[model samples]
Target: MGSVGTRFPTPAVSITKHPATLPRSPIDDDIDKERVAAAVLPQLLDLTAADLTDNAIWRDSLALTGTFRTFFSRELVANTWRHLCKKSTIQELSITAGSAQILRFGPEACWLQASFSFRTQGTFPSVCSGTLGLVPHGYSWKIWLITTILEQPLGFPDVDKLEPGPADTDHPGCLDCIVIGAGLAGLDLAGRLKSMGLSYMVLEKSVEVGDVWSKNRYDSVKMHTSRDYNQLPGLPKTFTKEDYPYYLGSEDLARGFKSYVKTFGINVTTSTRVDAATYDAASKTWTISAEREGTALQMSARHLVLATGSMGTRPVTPSYMNHGKYQGHAMHSICWKNAKPWKGKRGVVIGSANSAHDIIADMVSEGFTSVTLVQRSKTWVLPASTFGALVDPVFNPDTPSEVSDRILLGNPLPIQRLIAMEGIRACADKIPEYFERLEAQGFKTERYGDLWGILCDREGGHFFDVGSGELIAEGKVKVKSNALPLAYTESGLSFEDGTELDADVIVFATGYKGDMKENAKRILGEEVGENLEEFWQCDQEGEIRGAWRDTGHPALWYTGHGYAHARYYSRFLAMRIKADVEGRPIPQWSGSC
Candidate 1:
C-alpha cells in the first residue's frame, strides 16, 4: 500500500475559504476557522493520518471506496487510506467556494467546518463532495470528523441538475418501476427515477397526495422533528419558511407535499388502492392489481416498490372485554380528530407514547375537566426543547439539511446510538427534574438507552414532551399505571386492580402495526412476504433490515419510513434500480459489516 502523496502527483488545487458569519463565543474567538480549514485540507489530501486525533471518525460513502464505510481511530483511518490509495488515485481536489465556517454549539464546543469537491481517477472516475470538521486539540487544530459522499459517476446523469419533467405516460410496455404510496418516500423515489430517465409511476390510495397528513391525523398535531430534517429531496425552491414553519403542522406539511408533486411533475395516480401483487420469477416482472374509484386496474412493472411507509397503514386497537356493551364513545387514536366534540367530558386515553401524550395534552387544553392517561408500560420521555438542543449542532437552522443528513447517515447505527446516548445523558443532567416528576407521579419513565431502542424496535413507546409532562406533573392531567384495563363497564373501564374509572369518551392511542413483513404479507401474499427479512430493527451488521436493499424477491423493494430516510436512501435505491435496468454491474461493497 502506498501513501496518498506517493500514489498520485499533487494537482494544482484551488483553495477558497469564506469568513464565518456565526456569532462567536469567547472560546471560539481565539480560533481562526479559515486558517484551520486551509491547514487541514492539504494534510487530508496527502493522507497524513497522524494529523487526525486518536478518536477521529472518517466516514466515506462510495467516494474513496465503492462502499459505505466509517474508519474510527487514527490507525484505522491511516490503514484504510493506504489500502485504498493503491487502487484509486486522487485526480483533482478543491474546496467548495464559500463553504468554510466556524460552527459553535457552545462556548467550549466549536469547530471549523468546510466542504470540498474531489474526483477519484480509477476504472470509474467519480466526483464526490465531502465535509471536514477540525477541532482544537492542545494548542492546534486536528481533524475530528470528515464525511465524503459520491456525487455522480463520470458520465452518469447529474441527478441534481436534471430538470423535472412529466413522467412517461405513453410507454406501452412494462415500466421500470411502480412505486406504491405517494407519500414522501414514494414521491422522492419517483423524482430520482424521473431524473434518471427511468419509466416509473407513483400510485396513491388517498384522494389527494397528502391526505395521510392533512386528513388522517388529529387536529393540533405538529411534527416533533424540525422542518429541515423532514424536507424531501428536490424540494421546490419556491417553498420557503412561509410555506412551512420550522416545526410543521399537519396542514402545512400536506401543502408542502402538494407543492413537491407539482414542482417535480411526478406521475401519480390518486385514489388507487393496491389490492394484491405477484411477481413472476421467470420474467422477473410484477403484476399489480388495484382499484380506483371502484374500477379494477392492472399494471405490470419490472420492479415493485412498497413505499406504503414503515408506519403500518392498519391501525391496531386492543379488544377489551365487552367493548360494545358500555361504550359511550370509544375510538382509536386514528379516529381522533379533535377534543372539541368531547369538551367538558371525562376522557380516558389508553397507551403511553407520542400519540397518547399529544392527545392527553390536547384534551386538557380543550377544557376537559378530567383526563387520565393509562400507561401500560414504561415510556422514554425527553423534553422537545432538550431534543432540539441535543441535535442543534447538526440539525440547526444554519446548517443545510442535506449536509446535516450526510453527517448523520454517514455514521453506522451503533455509532449513532452511542453518540446519541451521550447527548441524551448531557441533556438529562441539565433537566433532572423532568424525569423525576414523571416518575414521582407513577408514570414510569425510562430516561436512558431506551430512546433509540424503542425507536428501532417499536417506532413508538416514547414521547418527546412538548407540554404534556408539565400537565401530568402538576396534576392537571391524571395518570393510571397501577393496573391494566380488564373490561369495559357501562360508564367507563374497569382495571384488574379492582379500580374503575368513569369516562364519557375512551381514546385508544395505541399505535399501528409498523411491521413491513406483515404489510408485505397482506399486499404481496404469504409466500413472498413470509420469506422476506424483518424490517425496522438493525440487523447483525447494524444496517436496517429489508429496506432500501435487496429483499428476498429480486423484483420487490421496500423504501418508506421517516422523511430523512426517504431523502437520503432514495438516491441510492434509484441508482441501484438504474444499474439493473441498464444491465450494468450494481455497486457492492465487500468490506466487513
Candidate 2:
C-alpha cells in the first residue's frame, strides 16, 4: 500500500496556535466537557466531512477502512469515509462511559477528547475503539484528529484480559505459535498470545531468561530511554518506583525480565538453540529443528515468530590493516565487561556511537588516565536532558504506559519524523553552545538529526549525551575525528593523517549485523529466507517493512525492535496469528483513495 503524500499542509490558522495569539476563551476548568462531547459526537458519527478542519488528520488501524492508514486533509478523510460507508454497514456507536474529558496540551493547545466504541456489521464483524479530538473553530467545535484502532474480532477473547494466570503447559501436539528467543520482543509477544489463550512455546538459546542483557552487554549499559517507556506490556504491575530507577541498568532490566516471565507464567524452554526451520506448504505448518541440552529436538507449529532481536546476534568488527600484528589486547564492545581490568592502561575506542561514548565514560570512571574516542563520521548528538524533555510530556511517571503509547505510536512514521525534526530544532535553539563546544573540539555533528533514519536505517550513527559529551568538552577524554584509522602499528593505531596513538587496550564499539533478513537466511536456510521481504526499514506506505504483520511468506512473522514496539504491536500480531489459525479473513490495505 502507498501513502497519500509526503507533504503535510500548514494552514494559516491552526488549532495549535498559541493562546496569546488567539482570542482568549474560558478557563480550562470552566469548559463543559460533557456538552462539547454531546455536540460533536453526532457529526462524527454521521461521518460528515464538513465537521473536520482543512488540515485534519485521521489515523486508522483496521477500524474504519480495514487497513493501517493515516489520512491527511478534509478531502482525503471525506473520500475514505465515502469508501468505508459504501462497503460496510455501521451497526452501533456509543461513547465509552467516563471517557469524556477536556485535554490540555502545553499552555495553548486545548481540546475536548473522548473515547468511543463502535461496531461494523459484515461477514466478519469488528469491534473497535476510537478517540476523537475536537477544537473550537469559529462558532462550532471541529475535529482536528481522530484515531481508530481494532480492539478485537467479534466473539474473541477481550484484548484487555492481560493478567497473569497459572503456568500453561507445553502442548504435546501442534501449537498455534512458536517463538524464538526469550528477550523482550519474544516475551512480550508470548504474553499476548497467552492472554488470547493460544497454544505457544518460547525457545531461548541462553540458559536463563535475561542473560542477554545481564551477560551479553557491557557492564555499565543502561537504558538510553526512560524506565516508563522501557517496561514490557504487563511488567509494570509487578514493579514499584523503588524497584528500578528512571533509567534501568542492564542488570536491573534483566531482573525485570525475569520477574515478567514469572509473573505471566509464560512457557519458556531455555538452553535450546534452533538449528533450522522449514515450512510445509501442503500442511501449512512450520517444523523447527533444534537442540536442547545437547539433545536433538523438533517442534511443529502453525505459525513461527522470529523475535531473536532487532540487531542480529553477531557483533560487527571491521578488519584493519595488520590487525593481527598489534600485540595489544583487543576486543569488541560486547566482550568488554568493565574497565577495572584495564585500569591505568591507555585505551582507544574505535567508534563514536552509543557504545563508544559509554565505554569512554566507563573508562574515565574506572580511573583510566588516557582514553581516546575515534569517530569515523558525523554523529547526531542530543543531550539526555533534551531527550527527557521530548518524551517526559507523554511517557512520564504520571501517565499510564498504554495511554502514552497510543499517543506516541498513533502518528505515522513520516509525520512523526517531521515532528521530531521540529522538536530537535526547538531544543537545539535553547542550547546552541552545546553543539558549538563539541565542534570546537574536533567532533562533527548533524544539524537536524534524522531520528527515523538513525533509528530505522543506520541505527548507530546517533548518540544521546549522558555525561560523555561533558567529559569530551572538558578534555578529560580525548577525541580523534580528523582522520580514519589506516592500520595497527604493533603497539597502537596509525591514522591516515600520519598520526599514531599508543594504546595498551583497543575496543571496537562498532554495532552488530542488524539486518533481520540476513539473520533469517542464516537460520531458516536460503530458500526460505530469500522469499521474505526486506525487514526493519520503512516502506513507501510509511509503515515498517516486514514486521508485526505479514512478511510475504505464510506461517512466518517478525516482532520488531525496542520495548515500545514489542509492547504495542504484540497484541496486533497475536490477533493476526489467531485469525490465521482459525482461517478468518484478515483485512488488507486497499490503497489510498
Model 2 over residues 1-593: C-alpha lDDT tens digits?
11112221111122122111111222366777767776676665467678877766777777665556667777778677667755656557677777778754334445677877778775558897787777777777887667778888887886546786667864868999999989989988988898788899999999899999999888989877888888677634544477888878888988988988888888999999999987787788888999999999999998899888876657898788998889899899879999999899899999988889889989999988799999999888978878888888888667766677776776555545655766777787788899988888888887668686567665556888877899888888888999999999899999999999999899999888766777678778876576676657655445666677667676687886888877887878888788777788566666677
Residue pairs with backbone atoms closer than 3 Å in model 2 (clashes): none
TM-score of structure candidate 2: 0.87
Please provide, for model 1 over 14-93, each residue's C-alpha lDDT reduced to its tens digit, 9 standing for 90 to 100. 11111111212223555556666777777765676678766666767667666555666677776776666556676576
Q: Which ten residues in a row have the lowest lDDT in candidate 2?
A: 14-23
Off by over 4 Å in 1: 1-59, 64-90, 93-116, 131-146, 161-172, 235-239, 278-284, 316-327, 390-399, 432-451, 591-593
TM-score of each predicted structure versus truth: 0.81, 0.87
* Full-model lDDT, candidate 1: 0.74
Best by TM-score: 2
